[model samples]
Target: MTASDRIWQAQLRAHWAVLSARRDTAGVATSGLGILVGDEAEILAGVDARGDHHLLVPAGGGALVVEDSQAAYIRIQRCVLTIGGRGRTFVDIVCHRADLSELFDDVISSMLTELATDSREQPAVVCKRVLDEWRELLRRRGGLLGEDALRGLFGELVVLERILAASDTYDLSVWHGPDREPHDFRLLGGDLEVKTLGMAGSMVRVHGIEQLEPPDKGDLHLIVVRLVADHDGLALPDLVERIRPKTNDRRAFAAALARAGYSETDAEHYRDRRFMIAQVAALPIGDDFPRIAPSSLVDTLPDEVSALSYNLDLSLLLPKALTDAAITPLFTKGTLS
Candidate 1:
């Protein structure tokens, strides 16, 4: 077995040993805090006087409880019953006896590690963040996550990485998180909305009418990325890994990924599903561009229409497609008014 696997097994064995010794004891018994002889971090576990099992992490913070009716994993401040008055929290992942075998050591280790990583944060905040991440992962696992959205994000990352690699003046620091801003990317020059077209079609989806509306001061451009599903092409995770190194700030890039509803743990599931880029077209949104903007109409529509979304035929915009070379200059320098 690998070193990590061996260490995890040792920790699990130690935990079980402590529990077995206290199997008939009246009160809770702990494996103690701090790193054990053959493990990383503290290996803590115990059974309370009332027979409730507990797993303690001395460095844990936050109050988070994730459950589906019966089973629950709770994170709270450390105190009596397990490792009393330790000033550290014990986040316990409680499961039924029948499900005990399904509770792998690595899963518990991952939780403990995640909790320990954010030890400085308040318990509630950390709990919420972890719970959100867990829910996102579950969403992805259930196939509720959008595949088209992921592809679109990958395309945008491709363009962002290209811009970063080609020009030193193009500051990615101004780039906004996915779907957070009106446009996909907010560069120093202006904002660029990235649209990915999959399959054989000239149609591109405009999420909302506001997407086509340029910022008040600067220009806006639409980047149309044509992709084809392929068994051997690059996947979303591949694109993320490629762009991660190109980014100026790694932490910011990670936060951007989080905002995009992506987690590293969930990335592996999408690793093999790939797409090949067929073409990339950049079009400047000008007065001539066929789009509906709030400023275009003086009076509101009679129906009070909201969340307007439509598909635009790119074949109609073919005449206005800017040369690929022209795309670089639009983002290379500041054009903010």
Candidate 2:
């Protein structure tokens, strides 16, 4: 086991011990491990008054599917936990056997470490994957993604639809954002980084300076997708279904969706999150583009000053937005150069 595994295991054991001491406690005794969904949501582990070990994974609102564990030692179900005075939904994984508490601790420890590593993924999604890795329970689908992630995905799909309509050779492979690439799309001509904003907001949060940095030999364009929430608009699942048929390769597209923390099983949960694309402006990133790149930061900030992120106000560049005719060459020829 790694050092992180040991730390998590120790914390779980300590929390359990404390719960055991106060068996008459009314509510759950939880120890925060790592983030699960949004900024306020987190993954927790504790022991009930009955002394059962449980792992609480936060989930978005949906019908909880409980697996039949008659032959297994653990029970999995959905529940509402009163955490910090809020009724939050969580996937409760309870170990019924007292003798196997130590083994369960080790498994929980490893799972916590995995969640810490893939901090971007939803905790329930991570939990499902880890459960499969251990092969201790039935394989189940994860819950819906957070609202921010869902909207961001919607924006990316909108851009993807445009790309597919404009290009003949570019397939789903050009979308490298799902694979955690530096940029969202890498076309043969150059690179295109996508950003999404909701409502009338003109500011787009840029993560890391490398996101705006242009390619060495080709041009780099920034595309900002502005969205508005409306009941008349199509939801994320609707857009996914609409775009799924356009792809020549369904298998690769499904894999891409999985990498993006989206599961078809959880589609029903996102039916209410409808959005309409307000505007999509493509701007060629140049030296004067409002950004902080490696070139601009070199010799000024130390190497230790990394993971830099900033907000780029699009209102300034909205006037410079390229027309459809001007942006067509990038798709047809692959690059502006």
Candidate 3:
């Protein structure tokens, strides 16, 4: 088969594997969340080809290898990845671990926020102010408000943008949407979710800010995020759920089964698939306000990453900086299911 065929097959298989996992995990922990798992979770021991014990190492050029167990193994492309793991806990080694990276990123960000010429005019402060204000106001206008008109008014691909926009504290500082490649978004360089909830007069809550993922990009997946409310008195998750996918695509799996040549009757045995995001950010908008990187999201990144890659993803939460001063309006609301 050709590479494209291989990708298609892999995609099908990946969907199958994910659906299988989702049947049980309740979405908190899964293969894609970067948690390197094995077929034998309860009982398995031994290392890979290397003398070091089996464990999750930073497989890619820039992931956190959460060396959880010597018996755990990481993979690449599709198969299990072979790598060297020194003595220590597996979680500590990987770059994807959030606690370490996020704390570090936050400290650095706080320092930078303080060092800026002045707080109000500083890019970071401006970003926080804008994001906080917008999210806050929306939280106030409680009770099933219309999302379409609200989002367009606040400016976002999802109605959530307007829900957040009502915040006096948070404004849509940056609204990033997903692009063709680089399938996901993260806080700073971390891949998870970053978003706000709340309304004016109360306070805004930001989440997925310090969440962790396995750093794994294929097959099994895990999605994690944090949620904060601006003030009090509103079911945020309920409102947000109105938009997220009900579940992973199960038909995608049946198709895979059929492709593998299974009988239609057997194919129907597969459970429906599911997907979820802790939070979503907006795409890059022009930089009227300074677009500071949420580097504070990570603590100990791999030895390799540079400062430049953090605010790079054209996310729906974060805006892209434009060179031209003129602002041209464009359609930026709703989601692609």
lDDT of each: 0.60, 0.74, 0.25
What stretches of model 1 exceed 4 Å from their correct place?
1-144, 170-172, 177-179, 334-337
Off by over 4 Å in 2: 1-143
What is the C-alpha lDDT profile of model 2 across 27-137, one tens digit per residue?
666777655554557777777777888988777655344543543555666778886688888877778777556546756776778877747666666666665554422
TM-score of each: 0.58, 0.57, 0.18
- lDDT of candidate 1 over 191-262, digit per residue (tens): 788888877777888876778888887888888888898999988877877776566654356556766767
Assess candidate 1 and give its lDDT. 0.60
Which 10-residue window in model 3 sums to the lowest lDDT?
Answer: 323-332
Query: What TM-score does candidate 2 reach?
Result: 0.57
- For model 3 the local lDDT of residue 282 reads 34
Could you give candidate 3's per-residue lDDT for residues 1-337 as a string of tens digits? 1233233334334533454444432211123222222221211122222222111212232323322222112111111332333322222111122212221222222222332223334232332343233223223222332432222111122322332333233222222222211222222222323223222111222223222222332111111121333233223232323322221222222222223232222212221211222243332322232233233334554567543332222233223322111111111212111
Range of the 10 consecutive residues with the lowest summed lDDT in candidate 1: 95-104
How does model 1 score by TM-score?
A: 0.58
Off by over 4 Å in 3: 1-194, 197-237, 244-284, 292-337
Ranking 2 against 3 by TM-score, winner: 2
